[model samples]
Target: MTEQQYNECVNLYSDNVYRFIVKNLRHQEDARDIVQSAFEKMWRHRESVEFDKSKSYLFTVAYNQMIDHLRKVKRINLQEDFTETTKGVQHQQTPQVKKALMEALNRLNETQRSLVMLKDYEGYNYEEIGRITGLNESQVKVYLHRARIALRNYLVSPENVI
Candidate 1:
């Protein structure tokens, strides 16, 4: 990744990376910091990064950073707490919906969450996700299927959605 490549990567994937981080971390400010730090790390490692591999590298760095943050924070940091931390928090009667969704997502293991996010949220193809996560295409597909089923079951539970 030359300086030019780094710029292009930022222009192309910054928002996607930011969204992924924010969704996982549930904190925009922390997400922002993580993104900036990821980009900075990428910039430093530019010489080793190939353009075609940049997106995977960016996501890997951001994902690792999020994991480290979660480990270091050492707190549950529930959805209500995250909403309160928002700068322009809105009072919504749908807290139950958000809570249910969060619970469903949390029920997934970290790899499942990442695979689901990459496939469903980010719209990455299974091959792409395989390359990013170091899983084979079949493994990616199988895990994604299982994750989706689990999420559907959790979300459609009577106590959750109702």
Candidate 2:
């Protein structure tokens, strides 16, 4: 990609990329850093990256970076500590249902959570989500189906809503 094409890619995809990272990480600073790193990676490989594939390339990079960061910080273990986190959130003034929803989201493993976020929040189709996540389309469909069922079960549980 030429410099102008790279610039256009950045302008066109930055917000979507950032939002995807932010939804996964929930830390604005860390999300910003990950997004910046993805763009940098794209820039470094600009000569080989085609303009048509720039958006997917950016997302795939950002997703990988976010996974690496989560692994580095051991945030994946947070799923095991969900009860403690939810206890604290319960004491906050946020609405009960929203808090429960967030707690439910936190309970998901990183891959499942990413699948839901990319599909539901970001409107990525199965093929696109698979491309970003390195899953096959069929695998993406199965995992996403399971994640939604998990979310629905969490939301509908009497203990969660109250």
What's the lDDT for all of these models? 0.81, 0.84
Q: How close is candidate 2 to the true structure, as a TM-score?
A: 0.83
Compared with the true structure, the alpha-carbon lDDT of candidate 1 equals 0.81
TM-score of each: 0.75, 0.83
Cα displacement (angstroms), candidate 1, residue 91, comes to 18
Candidate 2 stretches with Cα past 4 Å from truth are 77-97
For residue 94, model 1's alpha carbon misses the true position, in angstroms, by: 9.1
lDDT of 1 at 100: 78
Residue 154 CA error for candidate 1 (Å)? Answer: 1.7
- Clash list (residue pairs), candidate 2: none
